[model samples]
Target chain A: MPIRNTDHAWGSINKAFHWILALLIIGMGFLGWYMTWLPNAPGKIKIYALHKSIGLTILALVLLRILWRQFDRRPSELPMPHWQAVAARGVHIALYGVMLLMPLSGWLFNSAGNFPLQWFGLFHVPSLTDGENPALKAIAGITHLILFWVLLVAFVLHAGGALKHHFIDRDSTLRRMLPWGTRAEKSSPPPAMTATHSTPNSSSPTEVKS
Target chain B: MKTVLLFVLASGFCASAGARDWSTDAAASKLGFSGTYQNEKFEGQFKKFDAVISFDAADLSKAKFDVTVDVASVNTANEERDGSLKDKEFFDFAKFPKAHFVTSAFRKAADGSIEADGTLTVRDKSKPVTLKVKFSEAGDKATLDADTKLNRLDFDVGSGDWKDTSIIGADVLVHAHLSLTAKAG
Candidate 1:
């Protein structure tokens, strides 16, 4: 429940950011698809506005999460193979990249369409263009969609890896990221540091950012 | 002799107040509207509209403006938005194809500009509006620029779910600029 993350577990702030962003992003996925099925009408406009507002909310949360990461401590990676560790890092980096790019592209798409942008009806967001830009609109629209798929795949791998660690490997990686999840005692880590899943030297437990 | 001279002078002054009829030079005129959508202001125009102007600078109180705008001809540069604009919750082009603005009274403003009080009818809803007008004349040619603001909700322009004005603003600004040529007397 600490404000700042410790060397072995996520802090309250990071956990909130993670879960809140997760729910919102998932909600956006549903909203994005649901709105497409709607007939073009005044109601559709309102739905699109709602989608934009939530997307903007996700964007802000992603930014705060990244900023907090810079000043927070990273729980050391659970003993795992060099290859699996490297793959995990790659997935995390990809997720972070899209975390920023996804909302930004959505914003560009809205702006290029010359649609008004507002954040939960609280304030206005400026447009990327002065008027409708067909070329930019097409490009941004495609990028926004592609990023959605990219994020889906990357998060799948990321979550799958965490589950693998928590279940098959019986490691504490997944728990550390959960809101109320706790880290295992460092003294008796599950027989994880063997010759199979990881190289011997890689288990030296150097602190790493996830 | 003095009374006869005074009467002749008064009659000449009254005759000068007679108005000249003018028609719009559509090529050089524009009838547009703007509104704040979620705090971002956007503008749109009526592509097909006409105005009949009758006026005399000597007596603006006698001036009149009659304008009719094709609601279906609205173009906001975004087709999707324009489509929404023509729906029943907005302009309802199917039911009311044209919107009208006609002046009933005119008065001079404190700033020396003229104010035209008119009734604007849109989507079968009518509301009294005042257009702050600036007019100028050169020879037989004249130009008129006027603008007014109204609450869109008052006319049921944003009905249904769009009735929530927190996202889209309620106030809409309508404007017109016209170049007119006097008819040959």
Candidate 2:
């Protein structure tokens, strides 16, 4: 596949960035929950450090992905009802917002709680806030938890939407975003396209954007 | 002229005769320590401590120093770490909240610094420790600066998982800077 997105399909670069970030976010969610109840020990401390390091990494990657999205062409919305289109756009925006906010709140909590962050024991990230304030720490902690729940719900909805598009809608909405998959057969395009396209579908392996 | 000379001699003799009691000015004094945790250095302090000192520079045999530190007052700025430090495996603040240090002998070192041979008691465990002290007096104000190093394991500071020095270091550096007011006896 090409590195740039076409109106019909997402490019390889965007697919890679999306899937890798998805995996990391899921892993971070598990780590965050597990580390909270861990007994006070050296192992627990190390795991906390690991969690912080990964959260920071996700933050940086998401920022770069946002910048990349701004410059790169995005696949136009697949055929759906006008309301569904608007809902999809809203979900995309919410996902991006949660991705950015979650890491930031975690960083703020660590700073207010006076927990020093070292990136994989390589370099220290200086705290954004000064001395420890219990009040700010508690607030940040609560904010972080709430954001995680938001992210979790949004994630489920996103995955469900993708599966619905594949199994029920029978559209290229899911397959186009896959890292590797069989090309959509040209002989039998879904019936939904016939209403919009005047020309008979070509026999080429690649689907032409309407 | 004769009376003035006799009074001067008597005053000079009196100055060297007795040890004066010195009370630490708590507002101006600090008792702090630092240790390595996971290869990163962290600083902490005891917010409440009292030092009782009596000394005369002219007489080393008469000098005495005693200090009491509230272990529960440990502030590392990180509440979680501070909470763990006060538990049974560490200072055990609930059972033994105060750490005491008392000097048995005072001697002048070759480098002109004073050395106090002392014993430090923490969590009911007492260990012999020596503090290299530097003393200076100006008018009615006196300053005492001392530092010493002690192995945390020696006093059973961390019991089970903490005994691994690779994670939290074994040696803890303790230092004190005391500003004292001397009361003439």
**Candidate 2 colliding pairs:** none
Query: Can you write out model 2's per-residue Cα lDDT over A1-210, one digit (the tens) per residue?
Result: 778676456777788778888989999999999999999988898898999999999999889888888888765455666566556666777788988988899899998988777889899888868968899899999999998888888788777778888899888767777777437423226564553353322321222121
Which lDDT tens digits does candidate 2 get at residues B47-109? 999888988787878788989999999998999889999889899988999999999999999
Candidate 1 Cα outliers beyond 4 Å, as residue runs:
A1-14, A38-47, A71-73, A79-83, A181-190, A193-209, B1-18, B59-62, B104-113, B126-129, B183-185
Q: Could you tell me how far off, in angstroms, the CA of residue A37 lies in candidate 2 after the best superposition?
A: 1.5
Every candidate's TM-score, chain A alone: 0.87, 0.87
- B1-185 in candidate 1: lDDT tens per residue? 99999999987776665577898998899998898766678898898998889988778767888988888989887757887888887888889899898999999888888899999998878999999998888989999899899898888887887877765689889888999999887
Q: Give the candidate number with the greatest DockQ.
A: 2
DockQ of each: 0.41, 0.64
Estimate candidate 1's alpha-carbon lDDT, on a 0 to 1 scale: 0.81
Using all chains and alpha carbons, the TM-scores for the candidates as numbered come to 0.80, 0.88
User: Every model's Cα RMSD, please?
Assistant: 4.7, 4.8
lDDT of 2 at A5: 72
For model 2, what is the C-alpha lDDT against the true structure? 0.82
